[model samples]
Target chain A: MKLLPWDYGVRNLLRAPGRTALGAGGVALVTALLVTAAAFVRGMNGSLAETGGLRNVILLGAGSEDSVERSEVKAGVAGIVAASVPGIEERLGVPYVSPEINVALVVNVDGQERQASFRGVTDAAYLVHPQVRIVEGRAPRAGELLVGRFAAARLDVPDERLAVGRSVDIDGRPWTIAGRFEAPGTVLDAEIWCDAQELRVATRRETLSGIVLTLADDAQTDDLDLFTKQRLDLELVALPERGYYARLHDFLAPVRAMVWTTALLVAGAALLGGIDTMHASFAARIRELATLRALGFANGAIALSLVQEALLTAALGALVGAACVLPLDGLAVRVSMGAFGLRVDGTALALGLGAACGVGLLGSLPAAWRCLRMELVAALRAD
Target chain B: MSALVECRGLTRVYHKGDQEIRPLDELDLDVDEGTFTALMGPSGSGKTTLLNLVAGIDRATSGTLRVEGVELGALSNTELARWRAHTIGYVFQLYHLVPVLTAYENVELPLLLRDDTRRERHRKVAAALELVGLADRHDHFPRQLSGGQEQRVALARAIVTDPRIIVADEPTGDLDAAAADAILDLLGALRRELGKTLLMVTHDPRAAAHADRVIHLEKGRIVAAAAATS
Candidate 1:
């Protein structure tokens, strides 16, 4: 008699439970890997962000985002900008700006010698950017400097090695060991910080390398962009803190997107494989469908039943895929952003689940349609 | 006579690439209600074509054909399918039973198109199976049954929804003599006991002996008609 529409399709799917399981599993696995790639990208972007609201606008004298550290501004220019620009953020009525000299220095740590960019700042540096926390020892006197936590560990600089009275020779200048600070595993944690005036005299660098700025939270917003753009000093560059990270993402996005895109492409291939699997599943049972049609099932009802089977398979795959990617939750990966380890986060899981569901659903359409369009007599004849 | 199945100048052609082969050449035929008839012809003489046209499985190339007073040739393919489901029952030479289903489920298939309740369908299917002497074998699959039992189950499938006309394309063609006897007897019994109109195509002399009348065809033309069996 005229039975329920989807009953046959569901039963048919259940008949070969092993095949369904295999297809769903394949889809879930590919989806999880793609999500992991997305998560890695998000973690990298999060690492570069400056949460302390400092204006190390790396006023690049030239070059693109990837080459920001290489750009150098004359130390004298920072003094000129401070005098010329009004309303820079301040603390205790001091203008919230620092004329800093920066350079990358190589040092041996745990047998690996690597470049560590050192930003020589004035005592006013802490006033401009407050996220830096001294984790051990006291602030350095004029001839000394502080190491970021990650920088200290990477260089294998021990407490004995970093005692406030000791010193290490760099470019023939004896740099005394001072304090060590941590900046929550951010880009700042990979660099060394010191007093800029002393560093300038010691390094024989006459011009400041960069100007760090901090604007008051109550400062004007509408004219900031216009004012920054109008500066006419040797091609001055001004960028917002958020705008800076956003640019960082844009520069880093291609590599990240390529990784995820490869995953997505692989997921697409897996989905097509799933569709073929389901189609093969349907094709194997032509006689079964003919028998259903002969029993008086409407063509649409028969088709709908097959589609239901496919969608169920896809949903199962998505759930499995999501769970598979969950363990990548807060994984720490060491990548150089000047020199620290960045940890990847949860966005990869979301992307993995989305790809799993999308591919699973889309792949099912053709298989379901092929199953439903079976002609009654021809199907019966196949018997 | 006014008939349940009428073929007036029915002609059908089969095309093989560029060649047209006429299978049924403007033949006329009639089958009365509650009568069992047998059609005998050589392989290419078109006995199967006549049954297909009269049952709405195919349309005649030209000429009027009607089943249960409905003109089948004029209806579209889609409509013809609906009419066939409601008006005709077909039995194949191979006893085409869906391998996945039990005998009871196979018989109940045609009723799936009807508006019967679950209980009503079960009742009808049970009655049909009982009529075929297979009430005890309802749960058995086709592969588990003998040739006679399989064809009987096919008969149950054909008549399950109570279609007015039953067409059998070589119903006993593959059976042993004893099994063939049982099937022919069942078809004869359906005619006498249930008042079913059965048009069967067969080459078996014993199967034709159970028919109320037999028509012989040669090269797509009716040569002789006999009523000795009825």
Candidate 2:
């Protein structure tokens, strides 16, 4: 069937500037909220997913498998695992074993106290986790701290407070920030790293939080499991690093669900408001619609024209929303696991635009149906 | 003359909370081709109903309505709309010019239904505007035009598709005397010059005087038929 002129729909939007702006502004707000929620979920999930090394294994205390922060491996387990596990990956004859401690400590930065995630590691961590790169200065020695790029966001402080040569007070003692490191898209990007020996002394802890070791290309996780089982007296459990992070991801499923549920509720409300707005807008044009029908345009054609108007408004809103969201990319957001940047990636953008179009299409239906359902004679008589 | 609009026992029933109201009750009428006829009646009479039935914009609850030899009641909604696009041009009492479109675009609306290129549509639109004596006001929107000019643009829209019959409902009801006379003269010109079969519903005797024949209705049935003197 033939359609109405495209300019007809476009011109109708300009007829009532205030109503059009209000409708578009509502849609823009919804689109922005949807994109931000999508970005939040993507960033959180991505941080956990990207943090794990495919061939690395974590040896945690048997009962503490759920959380490395609570896990306490015997301090000597890293050396024992290196000697017993035949397929351990080694570089320059030094096995890739990082005995690490993970803790959440209250640190003072620029006179403000904040809780920050701290990981104690040796040089072996760089060998096992290849994604980390020291972008500034050098690794932290004793009485010094290596700050992640997102450490400031995680600490809720200014970036300059975490910069090299600045001091962060730990356990009431000032530790110089020696350097900065970046592990993009990973949870490690939000942590402050120091010497494992120093952290042990600072906390007076006798056990390591966990031992992370990389396996050779030919090695399977079964080799590490075998070693852990044979040395059961050590009370160690072998788990793939990826599997650990996956468990953490599953543990946070409720948080993701809450985020999605909240976003959907708000979007649903916005959709309803949009429909109401469109209904009023179309109701005012019932006679004009009927006049078109009287001129031999079918109801379907008229309805399509209304949809075109709505889609145009929604497209404008989507552009504004997308522009508003662009600056949020790579901006850090802190969670209990540390911090991750809001990923305004292509996938998130697609979802935002798809939702806007969906709003436009679905929002116009009830109004169109209401306006078109009237008998042509009655509609023409309507005031 | 052959009958262009034939109505046999035409009826229209409306229901309001268990009450059945028949606007046109078993009415029979015939409108000949190339003739101008006006329907006159008081409020609640089915003059406008009959006009709508002939224009194929409303369906009869019962009975047959044939416009230009096509059985309107037998056709589906889509077919009826298509038939209306090809055969009928409707003029509303309010002129009903789409407010957002310019005079030229308002007149171009009916032709958009056909498979015409932009240049072809522009040609038809220009000719229609010129015929209505508003070619210079083509760029002005309905709000920018006077009531008479808007009615003329509406007339241009009605005839843009060159339909065989034009159905007008109180075409001069909302205009002043001078404006109403201009519209009536255009309505007469449509019948005399273009040979269009014109069926108009009007409340004014002066407007009815322009028709070749006048049919008066009361309580949904034609009560009198007379030839116009003017």
- Rounded to one decimal, what is candidate 2's iRMSD? 0.7
On residues A60-152, what C-alpha lDDT tens digit does candidate 2 reach at each position?
999999999999988988888888889889988999999999999999876788998999999999998898999998999999999999999
Report the C-alpha lDDT of model 1 over A1-383, residue by residue, as the tens digit.
23433544555556778998987788677866776676666656665665436443334453433444555666667666666666667666687676666677775443455566688888667766677888877677787778775665445455356455566666655676678887764666756877877777766767666566776665553344454467655555666655665676677777777877787788778978988997888788776666555444555555666667776776677678767666755444545454344333445566666677667567766776776565444565673
The global C-alpha lDDT for each of the candidates, from Candidate 1 onward, is: 0.72, 0.91
Interface RMSD of each: 3.2, 0.7
Candidate 1's TM-score reads: 0.70
lDDT of 2 by residue, B181-203 (tens): 99999989989999999999999
Residue A132 C-alpha lDDT in model 1? 82
Residue pairs that clash (backbone atoms under 3 angstroms), model 2: none
Write down the C-alpha DockQ for each prediction. 0.23, 0.84
Instruction: Give the distance in Å from residue A4's predicted Cα in candidate 1 to where it truly belongs.
Output: 6.6
The regions of model 2 sitting more than 4 angstroms off are A110-112
